[model samples]
Structures are given as structure tokens and as C-alpha cells.
Target: MSPDGMFLVTFSIKNTSKVVGREVAQVYISDLQSLLPRPVKELKGFVKVVLQGGETKSVKIDLNHEALSFYNDGQMSWVAEKGKFEILLAASSEDIRLKNKTESSSTITWTRL
Candidate 1:
């Protein structure tokens, strides 16, 4: 847990190609306070890793509170609601591989896996 509202995201990727493979990691935050989840932030190409054939690499991404702000249509401003939020890790928007939840009111709890 962090006192300044920041979380460390770490994941691993492997390249099974015969040559160097290029990959991009995307981090997205969604507000889960309503009936349907609302996309708050879409961070694409956040981590670009080039790996040789049959290689693997570990990546770390820093997520701050500012990156979780959502546009409040009723209030006509961007805000980070003090409720449930989900963080998604994906190679692309359509390929989310992992997801975890956090709350804005207190410390965030997450597993390494």
C-alpha cells in the first residue's frame, strides 16, 4: 500500500517467436460504482518491451490517482469517485488478461499473481 495513492503493477510477458518480438502493455482504470462499468482512463503503449526469441521480461507500471479520474457528466468536471475501481491489464483493450479491484476510501489490496 502507498500513502500517496499510487500502486505498483508488475507483470511478465514472454516471446515465443523465432526473432525479436515487440509488445505493448495497456493499463486501464474503470469505475465500478454503477450498473455498468465506466472507463475512466485508457493508457495504451504504457510499456513497450522488445524481447529476443524465447525470452521473458518483467514490467512495472505506476498508477497514480490522477490517472483514475473520470468525467462527471452531471457535475461537468472530471473526478475520481470514492468508490470501487477496477484496474485492467491487457495487451490491447479487447485482450484484458488480468483485473483487480481497489477502493478510493482506503488502502488498496492486490495479489502479485
Candidate 2:
């Protein structure tokens, strides 16, 4: 993350076998607030990649304050809560491959442009 709070996440995958493999990478973000982790946001697309044996590849995902927005019932709007957030890279929601943390503003209002 930069001083301005923008950040990028890269997913690295390596195929160590003798044949090609196909898979989709999924990403989820959580607030890390309670005992049971709940996803606040899920990246909107499927990251389908094909890799030949012995090849390594990476996929980059960009995030801004807007990407962290959550539905605020009291305000009847979307909000990005400040503090620590966890980014999870997974094959499925139950299958996490990587985890990382970052911070954001106390409260970020979503603006359309």
C-alpha cells in the first residue's frame, strides 16, 4: 500500500508437474473483526489461468478505498471502514492460499464519478 492507501495484490502460481493444468483463482476480503471471519467483499471476476508444467505466472489485483466499501444499514449506503483488513487468496472460500493485512481510513464514503 502507498501513503495514499492504494494497493496491489499479486497471485503467483507455479506448475511443477509434467502436464498442463487449468484453474480459477478466487479472492476474498474480510474485516477480521470477530471469532468467525466473514467476507466483506469478493473480487467480481473469475481468474482462470492455464499453466504448462514448470511455468510460473502471476495475476495482479488493484484495490482502492472504494474496493473496501460495505453496505451500511444505518446510513443506508456503502462505507469503507477504517482499520485493518485481511485479503485472502483462495481456490475457493474454504481453501485459502495466502493472507495479508492492510489499513484504511476510519470511514470512507463512496462517491460516483
Candidate 3:
């Protein structure tokens, strides 16, 4: 996902007939640890959602300016930042299966128009 602009992706998950457990959806913005010369901004927080078994639910991931901001030259690196970001929608953090994954990368940019 682009660093400067808002990115939104929605995907669905299928819940089988297994005994109902607390179904939660989480989104993570990663790749800040290995940025060249380090990244000025760091992504935080995970959006959690709940669902039920035998049900299909949609998870939306939104990337905002505040969540993708960094510092450069004593100023916030408002642009010219790029990296691979992973948008994960999972029932739980440890469970890799029964989840969806999306990835993208782009230079950071912002505008008021």
C-alpha cells in the first residue's frame, strides 16, 4: 500500500461448521523495521472484528496519514517513502490459516484537494 495516501481493501472469510469460537479480524501495517536510513513514521494498532461460524464477514483495512507518517531532515517525511506492507485479515494472530493476506508498496504522497 502507498505510504502517503489512504489505502482500503476489503476481503471475506468463510467460517466452517466448527464449534463457534471468538472470531476476530486483525489488520497490521508492517515493514517499518528495515527501511533504508530508517523510517520516520511507524504504524501502530490492529483493528479487530468479531464474527460467527458458518458465516462470511467482510474486513476493511484503512491506511491513513497519521498511521503512515515519518520524520526526515528534522521534518516529517511527508513523501518519497516506499516499502512493502502486509495487510492481514485473520481470525487470530497466531492462526495463519483461515485468513486472508494482501500486500502492496508505493511512495508516500499527500494532498488536500
Clash count, predicted structure 2: 1
TM-score of each: 0.75, 0.79, 0.52
16-103 in candidate 2: lDDT tens per residue?
8989988788767777552233456566334888999888998887777666666665667667677787888888877888888878
**Candidate 2: Cα lDDT at 72:** 65
lDDT of 3 at 66: 42
Query: Mind giving the per-residue lDDT tens digits that candidate 1 earns over 26-60?
Result: 88877777433565546623788899999999999
Question: TM-score of model 3 relative to the true fold?
Answer: 0.52
Model 3 lDDT per residue over 10-101, tens place: 77766676655455555544444334454332334445545566777776666564444444544434543554444444444554333232
lDDT of each: 0.71, 0.72, 0.49
**Model number with the top TM-score:** 2
Clashing pairs in 1: none
Ranked by TM-score, top first:
2, 1, 3
Model 3 stretches astray by more than 4 angstroms: 1-4, 18-21, 32-52, 70-80, 97-113
Note the residue pairs that clash in candidate 2.
82-105
Specify the highest-lDDT model's number.
2
**How high is the lDDT of residue 89 in model 2?**
86
